[model samples]
Target: MRILYVTTSFPVYSETFLQREARALIKAGVEIEIISLHAGENSFEGYPVIRFNKGSLLKLLYLLPLAFFRRGGALSAIAREMNVRKPASFLNFAENLLGFGAAIVLEKRIRDYAPDIVHCVWASAPAAFGMMAEALTGVRFSTGAHAYDIFEHGGDWLLQEKLKRAALVHVSTDVAADRIRDLCDSGKVKRIRRGLNALPQAREPRETCPSLRIVCVARLVEKKGFPYQLEIYRRLKEAGIDFEAKIIGDGPMEEEIAAGIKGLGLDDRVALTGRLSEEEVLEELQWADLLFHTGVVAASGDRDGLPNVVPEAMASGAVVIGSPVSGVVEAVEDGVTGFVCAPWEPERWVERCVELQVDAELRRRLSKSAREWVEREFVADRNTGYLLECLEVVSG
Candidate 1:
């Protein structure tokens, strides 16, 4: 069956998990195509990755013809479904409009693809685009709901309508699934776990240390809670706990993190090693004793829906120190698999670090459990097979 992914962009260096899952689905005999609104690689894993020319509001011209001349008030009906509060959530509204305009620009290409499933990679504008495709081509549409899609301020503009309209709504976390259900009385929401491309063998002799070796893999964003991570490191240092940290990845907060490093007098102990490739990340994971994912709910209501690094870190045999947000808790059972603490509590985080440092037996047991957990619940082929089965049922 043909499955087309609708998204804002494709082949992003940071979004390797999406690429991994798409590759798995293709290997399992499902035909896949992608239409991205922004420019990126032309293809991924030998499948077409069509890019659309997303012009400015002037490009809203492409939509006017479709919305006004034809489609029988489809745009108006979609508009009517929206309940976005102006000024408060204008960004969400603007994003959905941009998604719809991009859809209009690529409507012909989407129709020619003739997909059985127009699967949106997000619940916001990408889903809006998929819904528009459904209105135009009569194809079944599905959406993915994550933290940002159904979080604070009541999610997207047309989230409820899309939730009801979609044949399926894939959510990576129980938190997201529960929120989606509350927003829309639709049975389409499905809790689907994200999986690794292939399980990374936990390196032997898990960690070699004189000092506590910690690594963090995340974009420098508000939701990532880097400030809290820095606070924990500071407290650990002050408490005479010898440790070193390398924060992998970079973003808008690069300068801010740099300043934090200096301001906290952690310049010697902490290093912000910009972005690293997937291979390099694994290398870091192998070198570290724990992967600290300090995530929180940001001001924009954005949070992580189980960052891929958590499972990757776990599968690599490094114990995870993830916040108790979204599905991080699902894979990371506190004290059993790894440790969980509130991002705001730097003292608790420092204590967990100390506990891991002192207890080698506990570390070994948790390492084994983390790897086992990934093997049992996060194998790409197995999870993607289930996804394929669900899609096949929908295709029928």
Candidate 2:
């Protein structure tokens, strides 16, 4: 089968799940092509990529005239008010007008390639373009809704219409699937959890450290609860615990988190190692005694459908302690694979950290179980097969 995949951005550093799925599909004898907004490079794992130059200064200049003028509602409505005759063509005229122009080039490519299905990875902007392309070409279209796309971007009638038009709707967690089902048909929604490749041989436990090393692999954002991680670190310091905390990933909250680290005088104990490549992140996961994730709903109402980091950490043989929110509970087994803590309570997080810190046997048990769990359920091959099954059901 031939599949055309569409997404907002290409070569996103941390979202290896999408890359892994595409690779798995291709390896399974499916022909795949991806079109996305270029981030930096235009290459990924031998897959054909069409990169749209949205960052060009000329495109920004083109956007300037439309930026101040276009208001709310349907793009067709905005174009009608602006007296543009081809309103549907003028839709998405600002913001991503350049991408729309790129889509024209992409549509020609699609016609030449003639894929069996068009699969969009997000519901907001990409789905709009994918649906339009499908309508024009008569190819079957589908979408996978991540957290932000379904919860934040799906309230609009336009977005809802695009979703309804999809042959199937995929979500990473049951929570997200249930929510999307409320907005669309339950029969059309599929829950396919994100998966990770098996880790290389588990690292031997560190021999020299006096206390355990706790690591978190996530973007330094408010929703990721970086401040809460800092507070937990502070509590551990105050309690005179001998532990090291490291955070990997970069975002807007870097300065704020750094300030918290300084204010708590945890410069030595806690460190933020900006953005790391997947290899670097895996190295951290392999070395750490435990993975501490305290994800919560951000002020903007953005919540995780499921944080991919949790499964990756678990797959790498680290015991994962996560927040008890949304799809996190599905990833963690609480007292089995890892502990779940309240989002705001640093004391609870610290308690779990200390529990694993003091008990090597407990850590060993959880780590062994975590790896086994990932192998049994969240391996990339199994989950990607499930996704293909969903696609088969939809296309039929």
Candidate 3:
């Protein structure tokens, strides 16, 4: 099957899941191409990436004749669909309006590729291309709805419209799938996790340590809840817990997080290591006894759809303490797979830390269960193979 992937950007660090998923699909003999809305690397991992300028009105005008000749039915359908949904702001309105016009150009491009499936990675503006492509070419297309598409500010502007048009929607978690199902009002959503390949072997038990070692492996973003992480560590310190803490990964909130650590007088106990390589991240995960995910629903309603590091930390034998936000609930089973704590309660995390610090047996049991769960659910070959099978069925 030939699958054309349309996305809003290319070569993003946070969206590495897309690269991995495409690689897996290609490895299984499915031909794939990427259409990036924003200019970036021309290709990734040998897949040809076609750049479609999001604001190139001149190109839209140039392709008008070709777009019209392809078909007006898809164009009109998309226009009506986009019209019904309310835009969040003037900026959103302009973006979608431009995307709607650009769809004609996208429709022309997709028709020429002649792929059996056109799938958009992010369901917002990118999905507009898929929606228009399917409408013009009569080739079935689909969209992927992650956390931002489903929960951020009531989802993308064209989400419902594209959901109604696509052949099926793909997601990574059951929780997100449930929400998408209600919006779609159908049984069209498929859940396929973008899992890891060649995970490092689970870490050996602690040999020597500066007391209990706690780690948070996430970008320094609002959704990752860096502020909450600092508070938890502060409470841990107040409880006289002699723990060493590290916050791996970096983002826009670096300065704020550093300030928080200093304000809470946690500089001596906690350290921030900016973005690390994939191997380095796994190294940190393996080195720690605890992984804290104090994820919260940010003001924008953006939250994690099961950050890859959660499963990575679990597989590395670090007992996870995740918040009850978004996909975190699906992975951490309160006390079985990993402990689930609310972002509001810093003391609860401290209590878990104290318990794990004192009870190696309890930590070992949770770690064993976490590893087992990850092995069953988040194995790359297994999940990707399942996704490929689903695509084959759909393309037929």
- Compare the candidates by lDDT and give the number of the best one: 1
What local lDDT score does residue 334 receive in model 1, on the 0 to 100 scale?
A: 93
Candidate 2 residue spans exceeding 4 A from truth: 38-40, 54-105, 153-157, 203-209
Tens-place lDDT digits, model 2, residues 13-54: 867788878778877788788887545247787555777765
Supply the global lDDT for candidate 3: 0.79
**Candidate 3 structure quality by residue, lDDT tens digits, 1-396:** 888877777756667777777777777887777777765678886667887765566777667666666666656666677678687666556555555556666665666778988878878767766776666678887788888777878878877777877787889988788777877846788988878776669765563444988888888888988777888888889989899989988889999999999999998999998888777888888889999998988898888899988998999989999998888878789889889998788888888888888777788888888888898888887788987777678878
For model 1, how does the per-residue alpha-carbon lDDT over 1-396 read when each residue is reduced to its tens digit? 889887766889778877877888888988888777665788886677877665444756556675567876776687666644442377777668777777776667777878889888887778888888777767888888886777746677777788888888888778788777876654667777879877776664344455888999999988899989899999999999999899999899999999999999999999999999989998899888988998998887878888989989888878899999767998899988899999889999888888888888889888888888888988888888887788778767
Residue 116 C-alpha lDDT in model 2: 79
Query: How far out, in Å, is residue 283 in model 2?
Result: 1.0
Instruction: Please report, as a residue range, the 10-residue window in candidate 2 with the lowest summed lDDT.
Output: 84-93
Worst 10-residue stretch by lDDT in candidate 3?
Answer: 91-100
Structural similarity to truth (TM-score) of each candidate: 0.94, 0.86, 0.93
Instruction: Kindly provide the TM-score of model 2 when superposed on the true structure, using C-alpha atoms.
Output: 0.86
Inter-residue clash pairs, candidate 2: none
Candidate 1 at 222: error in angstroms?
A: 0.9
